[model samples]
Target: MFKDLYDVIVVGGGHAGSEAAAAAANLGSKTLLVTMSLQNIAQMSCNPAMGGIAKGQIVREIDALGGYSGIVSDNTAIQFKMLNKSKGPAMWSPRVQSDRMRFAEEWRLMLEGTPNLDFYQEMVKGLIIENGKVLGIRTSLGLEIRSKTVILTNGTFLNGLIHIGEKQFGGGRAGESAAYGITEDLVQAGFEAGRMKTGTPPRVDGRSLDYSKMNEEKGDDVPSKFSYLDSTKPLVHQRSCHMSYTSLEVHNILREGFDRSPMFNGRIKSLGPRYCPSIEDKINRFADKERHQLFVEPEGWKTCEVYVNGFSTSLPEDIQFKALRSVAGFENVKFFRPGYAIEYDYFPPTQLRHTLETKLVEGLYFAGQINGTTGYEEAASQGLMAGINAHLKINEKDPFILKRDEAYIGVLIDDLITKGTEEPYRMFTSRAEYRTLLRQDNADFRLTPMSHAIGLASEKRLRRMEVKKTASAQMVNFFRETSVTHQEANVVLAEKETALITQSDKMFKVFSRPQIDMQDMMKFEKVKEYIATHDLDTEILEQAEVQIKYSGYIDKERNNADKLHRLEDVKIPEDFDYDKIKSLSYEAKEKFKKIRPVTISQASRISGVSPSDISVLLIFMGR
Candidate 1:
């Protein structure tokens, strides 16, 4: 019951594997997605949510590239919000509260609908490598499935260790068993693997909660969907989450369990996410704070289960219950399940190329938790790229790698493959140098053309993008060419508390003023008539506004990126012996040899490789 060959075989059917399988198959690769359980494909292992901060940008990027994450998220979302709306456009992010069951089911349905994609339920135990190239994979049942490329997205399943207080079990998730054979084989093949831990909070029964004691957190008045393709429409009715806090009594009860806590007792040695710490770690770290906020989020519209955000822990069940009961609004609450931490193996991402293929093993790739990243969005984006590159490799086409200036996905891969990470890495707005140009409002603007050229973005999507581009240009042109009289602008200006303009001004110039809004400028009747005739979306208008307002900053960053491009273009030969460069320090040579950075720009980002070492390399190269 197995094929001898496949173009690509994706192991694990989580976020990364699902994306990888879909992308490769959609690109014409005869792909096989093998997982332990088909029903858990694209499962939200930790939480029932998607996107936040920089992660949202990644989802949009995936969508622009014709990936299914955005569409699945849109179809499954129960509530939606635009985070950081009051901030700059670069910081604006779209997040969704999704139905976990629907999210996974949607992914499975999307994959099933995709051509060239085949599904199998099995655990790949070893790789069949020939001459340092991945030839195929061998499963636990002694069957070998041949493939030109193998993408390993074994998220938190490889030798997974779950800790509940002092008790430990071998499982990827709460009840899911750990994967075996691959980790030992990879280690035997000289791949370095380390342990990293991540935990999820308890699930509570919504019916057991006292909603009157908590503050209601509603979705945005005008909710937005994730996909730009309009594959799914937004819901008419949205669900609401609640906000509650842990009191001093809760902290005291939690403290009672500290002695037996796995994290505190040194039972767990792996590092966890710093930004999303467990409640135990938070209380220990922020001792001065009397309370910590816990968000009561619904698991799905059809279920009464709620995920207790900001309440992650690995304490004993009794302690968990007691501590939870001490929190406000949870005094009479009951839990569906207790939280636990799982430690799993992750190979440092530096071992992979920008295309996500392993440098040591051709046609072999890794993504998601296997690569040491934490979030669902990060895993999904990496999966999509890995799938694309795997397909390209099988087709004998050039690898599709995005540059830092191109998309947030590019920045994520570049950073991971270049610098590597010791902890469970998560995306942040501060990581991207060209954030102003990478605004979420214009992800399609930046990536749709490339996706269309590559045959991922459909013709219909491209046509829609073209219309948006044309309409936005028309709006910009109207603003640049149209002039408004002082009398027409004075009324709006006075309303906004600005001094009246004595003469005519270009609409662009007027709109550029910090206090002026496009809606307010519509009072001139000319602006309103132009907008009504064009019938543009708010996104296009917002993009034009950001372009005009932040033109200076955007240009400056572009120039900076241009200057850095020269360094990026300077290739560092893989076999170039850093030890031969006598001017380089011992530490720099050791670091360079280990990382083997592809370019001088990447070499500069290495932790121990200093500016002086870069200068020495440049001088030695006769630059």
Candidate 2:
């Protein structure tokens, strides 16, 4: 081997890069992580929290697959809540209000403790490409480090520009300097690049807020954690968030800065996240709404700073102050820092394969914001996968690709590499077709075996999974074998407003009722005795119940996915000429030739491709 050649080189040390480096090193690759500053590794760039809605599912999936994000979030969390608890188990997502500083420190310490990982502080300026393959990276200090495979998770630092009112500066974040050269180099190497903008809200002093005027939002009575591993427990005393709202006065003040607003004045040409808009954009778009909700959340347990969650703005400092003061609790607020928008370079992910490796540059991979994704969860999952694939490529092993039915991470990567997002992509429940089967409660059941097969998951995790499996199987068996008489089960069923049982029924059948839960079933002496004897954890019990309750829906989705996979397997020839197909419509021909979709199902999902067009293509391919 060359003097400084590493098996893998991971660029950037944000959420994606940190996870990527840790994963590659943990999987037996000698890895080098290059970042701008060591102190800023794994910093919460936009929010002082983790896991929300679909994002929480992604974090759990990461943890199940041997990634460290969930553990780190759990270690630093000040408050915990399981969102969407009123919905089905598939919709239940665990979230945490994290200590920002502690989260970064924990990630740094974890990476340092990994045996095969090495760290360097420097900005990667460009890659060393030889004959269409990435051989190494070149840093700003003119040091060249060779590696067999490289993963870029540069986040928002590639020629990043920050905007507040009309004042703009070149920086990755508020105080950090921008990275340069890589975007230009990639473009010259035949890669397509685009600009994307994302913003963060102002931080205010907690002591300055008048909380008595706002509504207090408390954590769930039974708090839950993010990690599948037993790394930490939920806090005994959780912090409470306050809720405020934007008044007409605040809207008027924000409108006053419209002339200098970069978003309005066309200074920001890139598309931002549709779901996460700035305060000015919200007021302008929903002009008829009387008010918008604002969440005042603490940054951490030790800091006096609070993050103004729903009040992201790029208005002038005076305008930000004048408008925030109009809100209920923020009437006497003082800002720790003003909110601003950052515009950064992103490569359309269509340029990458399913393995996250660049199609044009062999052995070079891209992840995180560099791939046009917005959230920390989205970035971390991508980074972990990219790191795994990079190490596999270096070792001459097969690429580790997750199927769409297997994980939310799979759905995310498949969407990115297939459709190529026009805006900054964030995860949503609606995006997954098989979400009925992809419950957060069963992430370990779905992913631990796969991770273990690939050598990323530990022996301890595999052993725990085995124990859980045995416990779940035993509990399920007991439920199926045990019967409850009408006299014993009728009252319990009626108490939940469900129909009273008329005859003896299996415990499994009763538990599967929509109205019944484990807690309610535990009222039966036999059920309680069985659970006590099995020594099953609440998570496994919940997972088994959901599996039984939603069996029909899950089966239906699986059948649908299997049917679609048939179409996916009917591959088109690489050089197939859509223009030569006379049966295809003019629009279909143009779109098919441009996108060059790999499968018939993908072509069918394209905007302009009709069902009739799909039939024509299928017939042409002898399907």
* Winner by TM-score: 1
User: What are the per-residue Cα lDDT tens digits for candidate 1 across 1-623?
Assistant: 66557999999999999999999998888999999999899999888999989999999999999999999999999999999998878899999999999899999998999999889898888999877898889998999999999999999999999988989999989878999999887887778989999999999999999999999999999888888876688767999999999988889999999999999989899999999999999999999999999999998989999999999999998999999988878888888899999999999988888899988889999989899999999999999999999988888888898888888888899889877999999999898988987888889989989988877888988898888888887787888899999888888888999878999999888888878877787787887787778776777877778877777788998899999999999999889988779989898898888878888988898888889999999999777
Off by over 4 Å in 1: none
Q: Model 2, range 339-382, lDDT digits (tens) per residue?
A: 99999999999788888999889989999999999999999999
lDDT of 1 at 601: 89
> What are the clashing pairs of model 1?
none
lDDT of each prediction vs. the true structure?
A: 0.90, 0.89
lDDT of 2 at 7: 92
Model 1 earns a TM-score of 0.98
